[model samples]
Target: MSAPSTVLVTGGAGFIGSHACAELLDHGYELIVVDDYSNSAPQVFARVQRVAGRFVGAVYELDIRDRQALSAVFDRHTVDAVVHFAGLKSVGASTRRPAEYYDTNVGGTTALLRTMHEHGVHQLVFSSSCSIYGEAGALPLDESVPARPTGPYASSTWTCEGILADVCRHRPEYTVVCLRCFNAVGAHPSGLLGENPRGTPDNLMPFLAQVAVGRRDRLQVFGDDYPTPDGTAVRDYIHVMDTVDAHRVALDHLADGPGMRVYNLGAGRGSSVFDVVRSFSRACGRPLPYEIAPRRPGDVATLVADASAVARDWGWRPSRGLDDMCEDAWRFQRLNPYGYEGSARRPGADRRSDGGPPIR
Candidate 1:
């Protein structure tokens, strides 16, 4: 790693991106953030500054798919590396709007790569998902397994990784780190920032948090007839803090003679829907209401991560457990019932110059 001092973070105001910006600032890297507030709010950067006690270099409200706008970002700053977290992340939504997913996820990645090349910037850390491994092989899947993405979202992620690999193969100067992540839950533990999904929350933990905070009457568990021990779908849930920390570690390793390196970032275990409900019940000091429903289309029964490779490579592992995820997530939900609804918008200077469509 060549000690990158500046980072351009796409989707910086979003859930994981915001946290990563704060983490990077703490590590003494200048930050230039880009997000259109599609799934996030602008006020997030203010809270991020408060947490880090450091001001970001700049923030731009623009869709990354706009090459002209993205190039403007690089033109303004000497971005040494980029941590990309921008995309439509919902699994079900991707299945429904497969075209949107492609136009944004795959298209945005290609645009970002082209811009990076033009500016002579090659190091990149991509926020990928374990969903790309969907329904393939057995439990505790590793990186060696062939990618057989089952859903549109997973396929988009797989496509992005392939694009990065192709770029590396052609341009060995490019350093790319792809983190194939499992379910990312929990908040910063500060209660200031967390997952604030618009309208209906898609992920399991955020939905459960909404129920705990009385935002919803009850959560609808998808299925309880899966072949798992608990007869419910299972997933590996890692705290959001741990997830962002992995990005930082990967960034630090980018200068270590890199072509392309992929690692699985996860807790190396599974948590069922019922198990999360019970955990959140204890965290919120009451049993949240829930009912079993038919399994949603493209939902995986069980997805666990064999993150031993990341541990061996980066010496990083998830220290937080499911209880911690529940506690922290509940804290954020309990503190903000509306989830950044009325929080002030404090995005730094550099508003979008060109009109662009927001991520939908």
Candidate 2:
């Protein structure tokens, strides 16, 4: 039998990485998932496999910063391209630990690039963030807008973007596409794989899910006095399905072009915090317990996307609405009351977090 065509996915065990892995498998592309399991668990691979229903490729417990280790994987498999998703992403945490964020996010990306160059794998799809826009003066932020990342997390993303741009400029053979994604929320419809943050979550959706499942007390409505409609902050929340689909589109786009490019992936519509809370209440069959709180540092009033370039160039558009996001998230919360831990506790399954939820 012939070896399957493979693509390397760094951080494939993480939330967005796992979804991208499932999407790639559905399209018949074999995968090589590389993860450090620092913020994610090895058991996620089993859940992804169950959702995929077949083994696609290898899962290497490796970090991107370790060039020799990453090179070893490249030596073993024919990696056509890489969907780079490994990085430290918490904004608040990055504020407290900027040096670690720079070392991991920036240093790790440089290592990955060097290894890819050594292995002659040039094509790459980088996971950038819309926070690169900082506080956009315009309503809908476009690709042409200048990026001024206020925090270390966003700064690291911007730094990597510059590095990839320079690499692609010098190495004409390299093909790169940086996707600047906005809020990535919701869960897979199957409720088999979803966003499972370690410890307490800092993001809104994960925090909201905890509250819905009785893990947390209430949602914090940050700044109900902002000058937006309903006096709340507004943000572009893209569904995980749509976010993964954009990744596929970016991969395909790289195949057509052999140079560096960037596109914003988002719903192109901003929803207020109140809007999200109301939607969550409607989806979960109960009112969300929320209280108005002062806005946190570095938060902007409204940040939506202009998405025309991605749609025009890659023929991609976000299909799911706010309602779909809330519904899928509510479903996942209801089914997996204790997240993946709930599945692990069933008879015949190991309760340990390291092992796959023993195939119940």
* Clashing residue pairs, backbone N/CA/C < 3 A, model 2: none
Best by lDDT: 1
Best by TM-score: 1
Tens-place lDDT per residue, model 1, 217-241, is: 9999998899899999999999999
Model 2 per-residue lDDT tens digits across residues 1-360: 122257899989898999899888888888988877777777777788788776647777766887877777788778888999999988778888899999999999999999999988888999999988987688699999998788889899899999999998888989998999999999999998888888878788888988998999998877888889899989999999999988976777776767899999899999998889889889998998988888776677888999999889867799999999999998988887777763332223212233323211
Stretches off by above 4 angstroms in model 1 are 343-360
**Which ranges in model 2 have alpha carbons more than 4 Å from their true place?**
1-4, 342-360
